[model samples]
Target: MSGLPERIERGFAAARQIADAVLLEGYVLYPYRASAAKNRLRWQFGVLVPPEYTAQGGEHSHQRTECLMEARDGDRLAVELRFLRVQRRTVEQATAAGFESVERLELADRDLVEWDEGVEERIELLVPVEELAGEGVQRPFRLPGVGETGLVHERDAVVGRVIRRREQVDGLLWLRAEELPGPYRAQRLTVEVENSSAWRPSRHATRDQALPRSLVSAHLLLGLEHGRFLSVTDPPEWARPAVERCRNERTWPVLAGPEGERGVVLSSPIILEDHPRIAPESLGTLYDATEIDEILALRTAALTEEEKREARGTDDRAGAVIDLAESMPPEVLDRLHGAIRGLREATGSTALGRPEQPWWDPGDDPGVDPERDRVLVDGHQVGAGSRVLLRPGRRRTDAQDLFLDGRTGIVEAVLHDLDGSVHLAVTVEDDPGADLWRAQGRFRYFQPDEVTPLDGTAPVEGTAALDGAAPVEGP
Candidate 1:
């Protein structure tokens, strides 16, 4: 609601200059943290240059450029060219600025300590964008919903808030917005169409009305006070007329539905909002309540004994060990087995068995389905598969290494990644080479024509039942 600040304008100017020369380049200016005091304030910055900047015959050859600016109280302005590390202040000078605590210089794990331990501390900086970019920067840093010029627009249309974002079970992102407040909520609704495969939110609105690119305007919608609205709300002052016009005329194309089978039909007159130039980080916090609530609901659900064991990354049960043994390499398997043995020894258990199973019970089938790679133990489906792997030891580059393996089955699941991939319980027949099937995360992206849908192919009944009171089995 407030106007853009002068500092932001200046920052944008500096950012533009840096981006001009190093298009697609990235830079960071971190502030220094105080060592001894909880509320210590220090100024320090770290510059990051992309590898492209140092490629042969590249424009810039510097590596990890750092600058220390003078802590001028009244006039806060600084700029530097490509080559130099702008020296803001020395250790002695920093002391004069009230940095006297020697313990402040202490680091956590001193593995790779670098220079400037005296004044070097990682801090978040609020610097001018242009200064952050260095001089002559042109390209904009595209983050989250920001655009090429750090401005957000839809179909060249500008509205107020993001009212609704419908992320379908099939990986589709649909957004609906009403114009800024003016009229009743019902009359203000306008749809904004964005095709995932075709459109990027960063595309700028052009003057050329005939171009298909221009068809995707940056329409605006007003966010309610709490930030989220599933249906619709009144338009803000700037959007009253536009929202009314859109509603009455049924202008924008929204709600993409099936046309026949291959193509999709979208209702027209997509509504949108331009991102504010300068706003508080919490301005749009209310809009994410729905997503946050959904997440909480998922977290609150109870896990079965097997589910809890797998969740804890433990191999106390035969089912879980089976899952691990099927997926892990020999060395990793040995390490895991040793860990389990150590745990059993420490707990005074003679054998490694299901954590929840009785000491005399080893035949307790946890209901692990190795053929389908789904583990239903103790009446609950233990785990499922995911698209992107985010395990602690399994980074993206680790490929399919991010999997929940058990004697009965192995399910690939995501730990932290946010790709369109899902966590599903899939069945594999005798053919381990058969196309991997996933079922759990609502999406069913079957490999093209690999398996036809049949009545029995749906998830087996009782798949959702809680796993409870099953006899534990030993590994």
Candidate 2:
């Protein structure tokens, strides 16, 4: 655990954190449902659909992305591209007999007709074109189509074709550029990735469905040598200025805009991370933690009762699936618990009652009393010098950097804001170099809701706890 594996594990953890942030960028829950009034804007990042195609319904089009690449003379490089393919399909609902009348039928009186829903088809091809060679003479290379096999379900069917191969396809696209043409210089390269799919009318179909489109969460992964990975979710320091400017203006100059403008405005960051080496070998692999997580999450959610039982009983991947199913969000867990309770009630098996400690229970202490502007630890008040834990489930942000979720810290001061909001200034125990007392100290102010007081035998330090005999207030 203390060697290359450890480093790789840490890298994956960091990558996962960045991916999680990107995963929640547009929507909060699973299924990535689109709401016109909510998720109104699509193609937030890495949008490549041409304006003409977009104007013509954008059902079928090619999307490409350009990035800056650097390599020494004659150095080989590998590039991996990862993105999500979102498909839309029509679902038909059945009504009970005589329920499709002037008046709406009651829940008990109406029965929904069940029909098989076909899976939407989306095809993606990522090609690293020669635009990176700096206007040099072209050398053509042809590659044969790759064939793959998988379960073909007519119901909810999804088919992917690459270079006209009809088969199930992996989501990742890779391209390798061998024998670099230049030495240790920055070069701009373009990756031409295309999505192709068509919607066909069906007997129960209400409207013509659009072809499947790609949704990039801006979580591209670049795998460099020596187990190092560059996460494109957050741009590197050098690219931050440009990314920030684009983010501030809510537009980007990459994809064509609605009015046929050369660039599309962005509402989020266009992250980029470059490798330190010059023209390293392109691994030609795609690594996306969030995409993997999403697949597992959806699979777990779609499991039937019998399948779930089998999963719980089986070993290998089936058992792992059960574990993933149990790892849903707190809100989802609560809903599941309510559903289980309802099922138990319907079966008249109240003998088990409710478990002594339900899975969704958050335990006794509620952390903060907003009205009192004070911290409570298991029903006890917290004072200066008392150790405490930051509340979990907070959205990771700049202001929350000083305190990590579940990390314990020492309370340096407790103060009130102008609006009567309580703010706790704490110095993280692990961060000994933190300047807790200064105005610009490493100590950060947190809302009472952000921290939970921990039990301590020592008495409160009182006014002496103040960094300079004056209490720091306000953000």
Candidate 3:
């Protein structure tokens, strides 16, 4: 941001916040230790493998993101490329002669294990909108190679040493723009990122060997000083055709910042909706494993002291997670459990016979208790105590409904959707999961047209042997 134009850096505070999360999506996984098997496999997304090695067949050597924009004269486009560069950390123990590279160097305080660490890197360039209009711009860039060594000491003697090595990763960026025929002056912007690194590997080299030359978790953030970018995922009706014509390869572009703000675009490998925001309830990133912060924090807290110590030594980010988990207060951990993003005027029974109500908001829908609500189905009154024979035939029904076609279930509730259709939630009598689903306030929803009214709420005695077939369909 230091070199970027002031306006380009203005509203990007929120955009960068989200992009940073994307960069660390898979940096590390559970049990965050160098020895952890899953930790060996990192950088799961947006990996542009070296071209020569990619010819052997694996992830592609490039990614392309195309989006639509509305810009005027004098508008400048700011492009910021961010990615993780793999830094190989090797531990070496001090020998009588000199230092020797060892898999692990054990110290009194902690263990130092050889691991691949991700170092954040960014490239910023501001190009005028005019430059990207006609033939556009194409340029080649390189992430300069680096190698460094740090001495490890204890008391007076230097017991061991650590080596960090990184190979150069070369890449190319191509930006092209075309004026589209539309109601307004619109342009299609295409950005292509390719990994053209010349590093070649030996026969049958593992992916780990290729990391030093590869682009890990690559993504781009585009800012418009005066113009606005359209939402690629949810374009307006007039711009749908143009948005569809844009071909995005491997990566997608989404509107960034608050909802409806189109000044910025976050092109990433992960699929997300427009205006994607990190939940305020989230304490911090857990590196995209399950994304259940509570569960990950709990598991992190449960790690043995020895394991925790190794995790802390694996990487700075891992150490931060370890410290966060250990120091998180109980109330803060509870905040991670649940959150209500927002609420609206909710209605009753998302699917009853009358005007449908929202099932999510509990207290809004008055006089519509599932236990007391009754609806007429096939000229028969059916409520929470009524029984029915399922005959599911809806075109959108799940395949499992075929098994429930003839099964008998007791109606648990009568629900209604916004449409004029009615749905009866029922629990199958013989289902092993019936109790579990019922306790969770879930039931199999059957429309009035999908079920036949059956007599009595109690299970027919001595007739459980009829299998799922309706037993003596009584009036």
Best by lDDT: 3
- TM-scores for candidates 1 onward, in order: 0.18, 0.30, 0.77
Worst ten in a row by lDDT for model 2:
277-286
**After superposition, candidate 2 runs with Cα above 4 Å error:** 1-17, 20-52, 57-75, 87-184, 196-208, 211-219, 226-475
Compose the digit string of candidate 3's lDDT tens values, residues 103-222.
777776567888888889887778888888677888889878899999988888899988999999899888888889856899999999999998877778778888888888899999
Q: Candidate 3, 83: how far from true, in Å?
A: 0.5
Better of 2 and 3 by TM-score: 3
Q: Please give the distance, in angstroms, between residue 121's alpha carbon in candidate 1 and its true position after superposition.
A: 23
Q: Is candidate 1 or 2 superior in TM-score?
A: 2
> Largest TM-score belongs to which candidate?
3
Q: Please identify model 3 stretches exceeding 4 Å from their true place.
A: 348-475
Lowest lDDT 10-residue stretch of candidate 3 = 466-475
Residue 366 error, candidate 2, Å: 49
TM-score of 2: 0.30
